[model samples]
Target chain A: MTIKVAILGFGTVGEGVWETLHTHHEYIQKKLSTPIEITSILVKDSNKKRNLPDSVQVTTDIEEVFQQPVDVVLEAIVGKQPAYQYVTRAIEHGAHVITANKEMFAHYGPHLLELAKEHNVWIGYEATTAGGTPVIRTIDQMLQVNQIKSIQGIVNGTSNYILTQMTKHQNSFEDALLAAQQKGYAEADPSNDVDGYDAFYKAMILSQLAYQDQPNWDEVYLEGIRTISSQDIDKATIQGQKWKHVATIELRHGAPRASIQPMQLNEDHPLYNIDGVENALSIQTDLLGSITLSGPGAGKLPTASAMIEDLLYVFQKERQQEAQYV
Target chain B: MTIKVAILGFGTVGEGVWETLHTHHEYIQKKLSTPIEITSILVKDSNKKRNLPDSVQVTTDIEEVFQQPVDVVLEAIVGKQPAYQYVTRAIEHGAHVITANKEMFAHYGPHLLELAKEHNVWIGYEATTAGGTPVIRTIDQMLQVNQIKSIQGIVNGTSNYILTQMTKHQNSFEDALLAAQQKGYAEADPSNDVDGYDAFYKAMILSQLAYQDQPNWDEVYLEGIRTISSQDIDKATIQGQKWKHVATIELRHGAPRASIQPMQLNEDHPLYNIDGVENALSIQTDLLGSITLSGPGAGKLPTASAMIEDLLYVFQKERQQEAQYV
Candidate 1:
């Protein structure tokens, strides 16, 4: 059996998914008891040169993807517009959906999940938060028995890189951000990361998952590292503290109160040592105390790795359902 | 529907499981789509005082537990003898089994998993290794795509506690051991922890999981923290290093090479800040780079939390199977 997969975008993460699926084809097939074939890839330009196999179809039309009997659709597009539409269409057509689009998922994930449930399909958005960290799965498991009291983490890699550079090298915020952009860690227009919108989106995703309820975005406090100065870094270092752009959410009175800000963390804090493009989440639960997971927050391979894990999960669930009939 | 469970040991973890289940009865039921009833508890001394509800039948005879319509059996026994036998028997009786017996599982887990597979039942031993860390599940997910290159961690809390005290307070190994025992972190024997056998077992379990092959017990190197002196700690501190009793397994040439020994880690190492009784694991994968998980490694509630999560997994799988039939 072959599982037909459609790629909604031909960006870095999409290209990574293609390469990894081909590179580990044998092992993945052995594990899933079925081979995965990239049936179609939707891109903005069909004339763009891509090093892809001849058998795979690369098209500019989204309808070409749905024309085939796609078993899964992976959305790697950045924003909400067509990614949400493509995901809902895939679910309606009886295909499972996996996405790395954080902006799309952070706002419409709950609704998409409900639609998938109604259609007896699955929606996986593990890459929408901290890439390759498995924080979503960890929280899902903990919620089985424990109440998540709080979640605190450094979720934005670009801001973290900027903060680490400013603290360690005594560079100004502008200089650090310039270095980050040159190193491909930040975009040219970095307001989404430096102004805390990126971390805010991730914090909302975590809050929704932990509380099973959407947070009031207006109520969530937001502060960015754009205002941090070189003197502030020196002051924090003198006090044995490190500045980290942290995303935090606490369950208070059965409601999730969340914020994204630059906080001075002591040496003993779980996320204190998480430096430069590394993400760490410290989750406090009633039954298990504190559990911290740290890893690569964002990268081409790491984000694609998360999406592949979700794909593997969808296949495993399908195998289980098939075994039930036998 | 109701799931019937029997626990075979009335120790700390068993008591914790009972208390947590009762404390969060409504929440657990809401998640599982069924209520779990502890129908019986197998204990050596039935007359011993236990603060348990009368509805739970405490029994001295193991046969009495199998006589009931048990769907799941939780084994919290300490050693290999009865745990292995009882687990095998439970599988033969067509019951899913979840165990916290590291010694038993480290040696006989593969055989029991095969037996459970033949009987079409599930086996969960999440508490056998690092308690409440979910390293086992994390490795399972990674195995779907990435090759686990290495696993390094402080899997034993007692040795870590001793090392922390030795480094921070300049205590001798004997004094640190005494302090650990007083703090209820070390057992009376202390051989399993201080002698590195406990960490050795956990390392073997991780090796088996990552490589799907048992490491030869004779080939695996093992060392304890008993030989570390105050002078060594002081010298390492001078060199800006700290001692950690780490369990490590590397997949070299498609085979697992395992070891448990004290290593001087630099400040930049992931496990350097893991002090006191906190446990930490750093997994190096090909696709996701390095991921580290740290949390409470051993305690009554933490260990029981792992078992409860496994129980929830089993129920979720059962629900999926039922849904497939519907």
Candidate 2:
């Protein structure tokens, strides 16, 4: 059987997903038991020339792409409107959806997941959390076996990059932000990352997964590294500490409470030495104690890799269903 | 649909599996969409007053368990004798098998997997590798999406516990080993773990998953903490480095090579500060860069929890197949 996938955004992550799929087609097909093809792409500009094969149909109209028979929709697009419309349309058409859009997911993911279940499809948001770090899958599976006590980590790469630069080289926040922008770690408009909304959104996802409670984005505490100075770094350093933008969710009085702020971490913490664009999460559990996962918080290839995992999950389920009938 | 499971050992891990199944019965059923009952338990002695329900039949005869209609077999027995025979029998009997037997799997897993596939069965050995760390699950899923560049970290918890004691407290090798045994981290024999064979077997499993190549466990280079000394730790510390018994698989000359030896790592390496009984595996991939997961490598609940995940996976597949028929 063949599966068609539409990537609703032709940006860095979109290109990375395309590149990975192209490079590992045979391997992925062997694993999934069905070949997945990128048949269409929803881009801002249809005139742009990309390295994708001519068989791929690039389109600027979301409705036109939805108008076709699609099996999967990958929402790699930024922002709310058309990306949300594209995914809803795909699910309504009975196609599974995978997304790297954390901002949108944090807001309306539960409703969408309910909708997908109703349609007998799946909403895979593995790429929406901490890049390619399989954190979402781990929580959703392992939490069944163990009670999650707490979750703490650096979820924003831009914020972590800025903090690491300021702490390591004594650079001001502005210079560090500029350096991150040059490295493609930060966007041109960096409010979402530097002001800690990116991290807040990520914490929302983790909090929901950890406790099955989807908290509002504004309800969680938020603190960004935009105001951190060299003096703040030195003060933390002299006290045998380091500064990091940490997204935390813990059970406070038997209720889940979320926080995203720059905290002074001692060397004992697993996330203390997470430097540069790396992100790490310390998941405290009842059975296994503490499990910490560290990796690149955000990158083109890493984020796309998460999407590929989601696609495989979708196909694996479908294949299993087919095998059962036969 | 209903599934019947049998535990073929009443050891620490066996009891853990039973405990997790009993405690999370409703949750596991919800996840797998079926009611799983522990049909029969094969123990060395039925006289042991374990906190099990009266419905769980504890028997000393392995044949008695095989005599009953069983859908899955969870082999938690140690060593090569009855464990290997039991798993082979389970596969031949058309029963899915999940095991926490690393020694058995490392020595004979590839063959057993082939046998299971021939018989249309599955061998779930996630617990066999890194206890409840989910390293096996991560690699199994993520390898489809990305090329594994390298895998390195601490796999053997007993070895790591001894090394950490020696490094931090200047304890002798014997003292550290004693401390480990006292903490129940090391077995009475301790030969398998202290001789580096344990780590070697884990690496062999990882090597196969990373590159589909399973090097002979004996042929793989081995170096245990038996030779590690406080002086070695001091020398490494002088250079701003620390010692960790790293089981590594890197592509050398475009071929996968496995090694388990003590390595000197600076603070920047993700696996550097993983101390005590915590086990960590750093999977470096072409897509996600370096993803390091750290947690309890071996424990009753931890290892048993891994087995539950495997059982869920088995039943989840069964449910998916059943769903397809409808």
Q: Evaluated with DockQ, which candidate comes out highest?
A: 1
lDDT for A298 (candidate 1): 90
Q: What are the per-residue Cα lDDT tens digits for candidate 2 across A114-185? A: 899899999999999889888998887777677898999899888998999998899998899899999988
Off by over 4 Å in 1: none
Task: Give candidate 2's TM-score.
Answer: 0.96
Clash counts per candidate, in order, are 0, 0
Q: Model 2 chain A — which ten-residue stretch has the worst lDDT?
A: A211-220
Candidate 2 has an lDDT of 0.86
- Model 1, A1-326: lDDT tens digits are 78999999989899889888888889889889987889999998899888888888899888889999899999999888888888999999999999998889898988998999999899888898899888888888888888899999999999999999999899999999999999999998999999998899899889889988757999988999988999999999999999999999998887889989999999989999999999999999999899999999998888888999999998998898897887
Report, for every candidate in turn, its global Cα lDDT versus the true structure.
Answer: 0.91, 0.86
**TM-score: which candidate is best?**
1
Docking class of 2: medium
What local lDDT does model 1 show for residue B137? 81
lDDT for model 1 comes to 0.91
